[model samples]
Target: MKHTGFRIAVIGAGAIGQTFAESLLQGSIGEIAFMDLREKPDFLSDERYGRLTSIHELVAWRPNVVVECAGHNAVTTIVPSVLREGFDVVLSSVGALANPKIRTALCSSAVAGGSQLVPIAGAVGGIDALSAAARSGLTEVMYTGRKPPRAWSGTAAAQEVNLDTLTSQKVIFAGTAQEAALKYPANANVAAAIAIHGLGFEKTRVTLIADPAIRLNCHEIYAKSRSGELRVNMSNEPSPGNPRTSWLAALSLQQTVLNKVLGAQWAA
Candidate 1:
């Protein structure tokens, strides 16, 4: 519905951040302030929106939630501090939690400040079903991520295979979700999201493929639990601004924010 005074602080002014901001503005859900190291984008020049320099500045702006879309480094360094300030964090870089220490720290910080770390289901579906099945005890969870060869550039996948000459799908990595997320931080966020919701990092199996035949990023997930078996497949177009990420990722974060804000409104 109408969130009159709600505010959101977004970390990172990149593609995802901009998209989320635009979506909020279009829906008139909340005001937005961006905390980023880079120069402010033209769209954020409006005086109503804030361009913050640090976490302290962002906290001072008094946002109901802080959304992290910068990357793994921001998740490690910025998110915990924001959470410790008692602001709920909508995390886009779920892959960063692959590091046990970072995950633990974020959890401790959230507990310390009485805030919550909300990880959105980015570039994938079936998270709600998987998370529900987890309570009933899941036996197995597997995720396969396939994307265009250019999408795998600059990541560990590029080093593992010749992305330029690949004519067919090549399995670049096959391991636990933790290993895959750690090695391919930019590409395996869906795997991490699956692990977090289903069988956790160690138990969730992950396979990453670089395919020359595909123009879209594809995600396939399979899980088995006492409740039943589940299979999901999604084909996502890469963001026009950044091929490394799916266009749906930004929209997912936007939906997460809306759900949080609306849920709060309903409870109130």
Candidate 2:
């Protein structure tokens, strides 16, 4: 139970990152440091953890693992260097991996530094089954995401559907996972996760729905493979401070961190 030497660094002090940090604080993990554009020196400071402002300072902290709850820019700018430094990473921006260039660079960095890049399951489920089915040859994987109409604001869905006047469920996008990620970056993590676990981005089907009747974010995945058929549906509450993110997504990241640091004996 002595996790005294486990060093965990969190990139980004945003809703998801802070949620993960607070959860980690409640556990036995030792020495948590946060790196963000803006500094909060007093944030989460305790006997075991502190905060760092610059990436240079974070590098000096020498973390065993780094969890990226930052956005896509962090994935491109911060992740590669951490991986190249031989530190494992847990990424919240799984959608960013869909980019060919970034994916290639991350994979190369992980190999070069002998590090592992772990992507959390986010707001979905059945990833274990999907991964197992993938080995036996998955024929199809489909994801349908539904959230309140206001949640579709600022995305391409705004242009396609009039979210203001929408009273019922509307299909804003029906395309491949790649297209979904390109058009709706904010809501692409679940789709990207399904694609990664089951099929490649181009082969996995994706659908984005805006429903006025729904309060929480909902995800439904249907997959068919040589082994069997699977369907998973999740209704996740929005994070308290950030409605754009599901609370379960933050909890999933915490669980991933605990599992990695504590070995296979820890289960969430």
The 0-to-1 C-alpha lDDT of every candidate, in the order given, reads 0.91, 0.86
Per-model TM against the reference: 0.95, 0.92
Maximum-TM-score candidate = 1
Best candidate, lDDT: 1
After superposition on all CA atoms, how large is the RMSD of candidate 1? Answer: 1.5
lDDT (10s digit) by residue, model 2, range 19-120: 888777777667788887765544545545577776678778888789998889999998998898888999999999888899999999999999999999
Tens-place lDDT per residue, model 1, 96-181, is 99999999999999999999999989999999999999988999999999899999899887777888999888998999999999
What is the TM-score (0 to 1) of candidate 1?
0.95
- Residue pairs clashing, model 1: none
